[model samples]
Target chain A: MQNDTPELPIFPLILSHAMRPLPLWPLSAGLSRLAGHILHRHPGINNRIDYYQDHVFLLDITDLPLFLTLEPRKARLRAFRRSAVVPGHDAGISGPLAAFLAMLHGQEDGDTLFFSGALAIDGDTAAVLALRNALDDAELDLAAELAELLPPIAGLLRAGLPGMQHLTGLCLQRGSAASERAW
Target chain B: MELVCPAGTPAALRAAVDAGAHSVYCGFADATNARNFPGLNFSRAELEAAIDHAHARGAKVLVAINTFPTAGEEAIWHAALADAARLGADAIILADPGLLAHAAERHPGLRLHLSVQAAAANPDAINLYARHFGIRRVVLPRVLSVEEIAAINREIDIETEVFVFGGLCVMAEGRCALSSYATGQSPNMNGVCSPPDHVAYTSEGDDTVARLGGFAIHRTPRGAPAPYPTLCKGCFVSGERQGHVFEDAVSLDASRLIPALARAGVSALKIEGRQRSRAYVAQIVSAFRAVTDALAAGREPPALALARLAEGQAATTGAYAKRWR
Candidate 1:
C-alpha cells in the first residue's frame, strides 16, 4: 500500500537552515513571549503540568537546527542552536516539526508517533508524558495562537493555514475533518 | 457476537461508533475506571453525549466504573453508578463486589457486566457474581486459554467477553500490584497501571532505558523502537538471567482466534486501549468488525496487518493458546 501520509515539506527545512546563521537571543525572547501568552490564555495547561513545575523540558525539532528548553516553573521558553552545548534538562522530546504539529493539532497520536519511531523521548519519561498530556488537553493551534498574539497577521494566518496544511498534509487545526477522513 | 470497543474521549466514542462498533465502553475522567490517565476519558456531559451518539447509530454504550473504591470513598463509586444509570448506559462494567451489590440493589433496571479487573476466571467465581449480583456478562481475564475459556463457558451461564487485541496484562487482571509497588498507584485502586507520573526514559550511552518509578524496565538501542515502561513487560535481572523475566513487550492480537472464540461461546470481543487515539480506535474497531462480519457471512477472515498498531510493533495470542506456558 502506497503510504498516503504526507512527507515533511522541504520548505520548513530550508527556512530552518536559513535561520541557522541568525542569533538565538531574538528567537529565545520571542518564544518566551509566546509561552507567556499561551499560559495566560490557557491557565489549565499550567495547572496540568504543575507536577512537572520543577522539571525542565527540551523540545528538539530534528528537522530544524533548533532546540527549545521549556521551564514550567519559570514560565520560560528558551531556544538554542541544535549544535550548542545546552544545559542539562529533566527530559527531552525530539521529533520532526510535523510530528509535533500533528500531535498538537490532534491529527496523530503521541504514542503512535513514538511507537513508529517518528518521535523519541529521553531523560524523564514521566515529565514528557505530563507535558504531552497537558498539551493534548490544551488542543493548541499554533497558527491561531500566533494570530491571536499578533492581530495584524491574524487574517493572513487564518486564510493561509488551510493552504499550508494542504501543502504539508499537516493537520494545523483541532478536529480537522479532512485529517480524520484521511485516516 | 458483540464488538465492544474502548473510547477514552467523546471523539473516540464517535469514531468507534462510526467504525461499526456494536458497543463502545468508556469511563468518567476520574479514578472510577482502570484507564484513569491524564487528558483521557470523558466528563459526565461528554459521556451523556457519547451515549446519545452511540445509541443514535444503533450501538450501545457501556460505562466502566471498574476500579475498586477506596476504604472511605464508597460514595464516589456509588455516585458513578447512579450517574451511569441516569445517563442511560446500556450497561455498567464493575469490578468491586460492594459496588456491584450497590448497583444491583439500587439500580435494579440497569444491566451489569463483571469487569476483567475482577479476575473472575473460574465458573464458580463467574457464576457467583451472576447469581449474587445479577451480572449478565463477565469480561474474562487475559490469563485463560481458549480451551479453558470454552470449559468455563460450558459451566457458566452468563455471557463472556474476551480481549481480542491491544495491550496485554502479564499478571492476572485486578490482582497485579507491581505498579503500586513501584509507583504507589494501582489499576485496581487508582485505575492506572505503571502510572505515567512515575515513568521515565533516559539515554545511557547508545541505549535508551525505560523506567517506572526509577526501576529499570527495558533498555533498547538508541534509535530503535522502545515499548512503554509497563512493569510486567519489563526487562530485569533475576539471579543470573538478564532479560524480560516476566513477559516480552508485546500487545495481544487475538484476531486470528475470532472463530475459535465464537465457537467457545464468547459473547463479545473487547479491544483494550482507552488511552489510545481515536484514529487507532477507528482503525482497530473497523478491522475487528470486518473480521466478525466475515465470520458471520461464512467467509474466511481477511488477513489483517495490524502489527503497526501493536505495542512495539509485535503481537501475541497471549495465553489463548497456552503456547507461552
Candidate 2:
C-alpha cells in the first residue's frame, strides 16, 4: 500500500515537449514585456538615456539562444525580440547569463564587466556607455520584479530562478533512475 | 544575547523588527552613521516613524551618531546626539570621545553605547569610556579572539557587543585610512568607505576589472564574479605574488560561534549591513533570530543558510577563532 506511486517521467522529454510549442520568439516577447514593465516603473532610467533616444541596443545572451533589443519609443523605453525584419541595432552586447542578469538587476557593475572583458560590446561604444549609466542609475532587482510579475510563483523562485533548475535536475535524476530500472 | 541589527532605511528597520530583532540600529541621512552610502539612511521623520514601528513590535531603536567630529564641525555631531535624545531613541551609539562626553553631559538620561569605530579593544579603553562618559556598552572591534573578548569582559564593567555577521574590515575599526589614501573619503569622518562615486569597472579581453579611485582592485576572469572595488580586499602584486594581499573578499559569519560569544559575556550580537536592502535585512535578521532563539532554547543553532548571500560567496568566522591569525 505504501509503494503504489507512479514513477517519474524523463525530464528531457518533458522539457522538450514543454519548450517545443514555446519557441524563443514568444519567450523573448514575454521577457521583453517583463523588462518593459520594470523599466516603465522607474522613469529615472529613461531620463538617464533620454539623450540616446535614437539608439537601439541588442543584448545577446551567449548561454541562452535569445536576444533582446531595447530602444526608446513614445517617451518610454521598450524592449523587443530581435528578428530578421527588425532594423539593425546601434550596438550589440554579448555575455553569459550571469553578466546580463547582474546588469539587468543592477547587481553587477557594467563598467567592471566591460573592463574585465566579461562582457563584449560591438558597433557603438557610446550607446553602450549610455545604457550602462542608465542601468546604474536604476538599481532594479530582476528576481523581485519577476516575482511581482508572477505573484503566485514568487516564493518558488527566490534568489533568482535556481529553484526551477533544482526541481528540473531532481526530476531528471529520478527519471534516469527509473530508466535504469526498466533496462 | 541581545540581537542588535542594522537598518539603513525605514523599510529595512521594519524588516528587522518584523524578523525578531531585539534592537534595530540606524543613522540619519547624513554623515553621522558609519554606512554613509548614497541613497541610504533615514531622515528625521523616517527615524521617528521607524522608532514607532519598532516600539510597537517590542523592538528598540538605537541611533548611531558615530562619526568623528571634524575640527570646526563639532556642533553637527553634538546636534546629531541631541536630536537622537529628542527623538526618544532607546540608545545612542557614539564613537568620538568628545562626542561621547558631549552626549553624556547634554543628554544625561540617554543610554550611550560605544561604536566599534572607537576601537576600544582593551579593558583599559572600555573602562575609561564607561567611567568617563557612562557608556552602557562597547561594540568591540572585529580584531579580538573569543578568549581575548572573555578576558576583556572579565575586567570591564560595561556591556560588550561584538559583530557576529556581515562585512569585515581588515584594519582596526577606527584607525584605517586606506579609503582616504585611495579616494580621499575618510570612513571615520565621511562615514563612507570606498565611496561608490570613485568606483569604476572595465572589460579587458576575458576578464572583468573593478577599479576604485583609478586603481585596479579586482579582475576576475569571464563568468567569474568580480569583487566589489574595496581597497583592502584588492588583489595586489608584491614579491612575485598576485592576490588579495590585505584580506580576501569574505564576509564575517560568526553564527557557528554564538555559544562561544555568549560564553565570552557578549551582551549583544551586531550585524554590519545598514547599507543593505530591506529584503536582505529581513532574511539575515530572521536567520540570526532563529540561531539566537535556538541558543535560548538550549538547542543547537540551525545550519547556516546565509553563505549564498555573503560577499564573494564566502563567509568566515573572521578574528573570532585562532584560524584568522
Candidate 3:
C-alpha cells in the first residue's frame, strides 16, 4: 500500500517562510472576520460549541510558520508568527495545514488522523472533540464561504477548487468525496 | 451472518449502506442513543431519509434507543420509540427493562434487539429477555469468550450478535459507573461516558497530562500519539504498579475470528464507533463486508490492516479469547 502519511507542499512552506518576519495583525483581523462570517452564516455552530464558549483553542499549523488562537465566545481568532511567544490556550490541536484542511472539509476522519500521528492534540481533549464535532456537523466549505464573502471571485473559486483539491489532495467540499480516495 | 454497522449521522448511514453493510444501526440525536455526543447522531427527519436510503439499497436500518430512561424523562424515551416505529425502522436496539417492556407492549410489531448495554451474557438472562419482551436478537457484551458465546447460543432461542470490531468496554456494560463518577454523565443514564466537556489535557514540562474530571489519567511524552482518556483505559498506580490498571488503551478487532464466531452460531457481527466519521464508517464496513462475504463463499478472509483506525493504534480480542485473566 502507498504511504498515507500526509506531506506538506513546498509552496505553503515557502509562503510560510516568507511571511515569518511579517506582522500578523492584518492576518489576525482577516481570520477573525472570516470566523465571524462563518458564525453569521451558520448560527447553529454556536450552539454546538456552546460548552466551549469560554475556552480558548490554539490551532498550530505545523507545516506553516503560523499559530492561531480561537475564542469562540467572542468569535475572535488571533494569528501569531511561529517565532512569537506562544499564547496561552486551554486546548491545542497541532497538525499540518493539509490535515487541518482535510479534517475541516470532511476529507479525513479526525480520529483516524490522530491515530495515524498526522495530528496531535493536547491541553483539552474534550474541547477539541467538541470543536471537531461542531465543525463536522456544520459541514463548512471554506471555498464556498470565501466565495460568498467575495462574490466577484465566487466563480473563479468554484472552478479552481477541484483542481486545487486534486493538486493538494485536500478535500474542499463535504460529502462522500473522501470515500472515493484511497486510505 | 449479518453485518451491523454504526452510523452516528445520516451521512455515515449512507456511507455504511453504500459500502455494503447488510444492516446499519443509528440513534436519535437525543440521549436516547448511546453515542449522544455533541453534533453527532441523526435528527428524526434525517433518520427518515437515512432509512429510505438504506432500504433502497437492500440494507436494514436499526434505531438505537439503548440508554436507560431517566425516571421523569421516560416520556422522551417513549417518544423516541414512537418516532422510530413511525419512521419505519427495521428494528430498535434497546437495553433498559422498563424501556424494553414499553417497546414490546406499545410497539409490538417493531422488532426488538437487545443492546449490548443490557449485558445479557448467559442463557438465562437472554432467555428471560426473549421470554418477557419477545426480543428477536441479543447483542452480547464484549466480556464473553467464543466458547462461552457458543455455549450460550446452544440454550438460547433468540438470535445472537457479537461485537466484531471497535471500542471494547473493560467492565460489564450497563453496570459501570466509572464515567459518571468522574464526569457526572454515563452511557447508561446520559448516553455518554467521560464526556468530552469534562476532559482536559495540559502540558507539564516534557510530558502532556490527560485528565478526566480533574484526575490525571495519562501522561505521555511530548509529541507522542496519545489515546483518548477513557477512564477504564487510563493508567493508574496501585501499590508500585504504575501502568494501565484496568485495561490497556486498545480497541477490539475480531476480524481474524470471523470463522470462529460464525461457527459459534452468532447471527450477526457488530462494529462499534457511532461517533466515527463517514470515512471511517465506509472503510470499516467495506472491510468487514469483504471478510463476511469471503467467509460465506468458503474463501480465506483477507488480512485487514486497520490498526490506524484502532484506539491507541492497537487492537485486541478483548475477553473473546479469555486471555486477559
Give the number of the best model, judged by lDDT: 3
Worst 10 residues of 3 chain B by lDDT: B185-194
Model 2 agreement with the true structure over A1-183: per-residue lDDT tens digits? 011111222244455445444555566567667767777776655554555656788777554433557775433233333333443677768776556655544344453454334566666544565566555434455556677888997877655456654654321111111122110
Worst 10 residues of 2 chain B by lDDT: B220-229
lDDT of 3 at B86: 98
The residue ranges of model 2 lying beyond 4 angstroms of the native Cα positions read A1-183, B323-325
TM-scores for every candidate against the unseen true structure: 0.86, 0.71, 0.89
Residue B61's C-alpha lDDT in candidate 3? 96
Output the lDDT of residue B208, model 3: 76
Clashing pairs in 3: A123-B201
lDDT, residue B42, candidate 1: 71
Judged by DockQ, which candidate is best? Answer: 3
Instruction: Give the fraction of reference interface contacts each candidate recovers.
Output: 0.33, 0.02, 0.36
TM-score of 3: 0.89
Docking class of 2: incorrect
- DockQ agreement of candidate 2 with the native complex: 0.06
Q: In order, what lDDT does every prediction score?
A: 0.82, 0.71, 0.82
Clashes of 2: 16
**DockQ of structure 3:** 0.35
